[model samples]
Target: MELLIKWLSIALSSSVKFFAGPLLGKVYNLPWWQTAICSFLGMMVAVILFSTVARAFFHKYMKGLFNRNERRITPNKRRMVRIWNKFGISGIAFLTPILLTPIGGSIVAISFGTHPMKIIGYMAVSAAFWAIVASIGIYFIPFNFH
Candidate 1:
């Protein structure tokens, strides 16, 4: 039960914030493999949920909240467009764990009209890669957690 709690905690943390999973694993002294798998699964779950179900729900029920007529150009949106033009899905996926949360990244991809399966594929690969990197870095590096 205690171990299950720890695993769930790691998963929950990564589901919301990717970096938190590695930090929590270090604090808990969990093995690198456990950290990697849990974090990857957590992020993938978020990506899937946001890319599919939440997206449809929001488009259907929350359409009035967005107000497309009120849309205006912003520097951030311009920059995102530039990035999208330059890097495409690969760039977005690479930046997902590093710069964007899984849900946020999925939303960005979905807004751009990318296929859902493509979003899932790229996100899965990115999550797996980053999970491995973060878990290894956190567990191997000695940090003064005091």
Candidate 2:
């Protein structure tokens, strides 16, 4: 029905931005708030789905996909590990949204042994923050000048 289509459109549009904000912004003609809300919601969905996938299917079915190639943990890795260790789930959750893709962030949180609940909580907050900032930036900046 019409209502279902509309809801589906909103969900799809928002979810796409959740994964790829810049690309979705160009394609959807959505204002920043729309994008933000949709993207945040989408990211939350993605995080939850990803957490489930990572635990139930991805680890076994997509082992190669998630496999680490680098042998050296590197200074950045060390720093991340240290932060995660120090702050526990909070650190991973807070950083995941900003530092990684919805999928990547979820994977990293899992790899770091962050709890699923904490991962979702952190990602939700981080996604909301970025969405707000992105929306504000898009709204205030003038574009398409005559």
Index of the highest-TM-score prediction: 1
lDDT score for residue 58 of model 1? 66
Model 1 — which ten-residue stretch has the worst lDDT? 58-67
In terms of TM-score, how similar is model 2 to the real structure? Answer: 0.67
Which residues of candidate 2, in runs, are more than 4 Å off?
Answer: 1-19, 58-71
Clashing pairs in 2: none
Candidate 2 lDDT, 58-134, residue by residue in tens? 66776665476956668877877797779776676666655656777787677765678878888888878877776
Top candidate, metric lDDT: 1
The lDDT of each candidate is 0.87, 0.66
Q: Runs in model 1 with CA error above 4 Å?
A: 61-71
Residue 21 displacement (Å), model 2: 2.4
TM-score of each: 0.91, 0.67
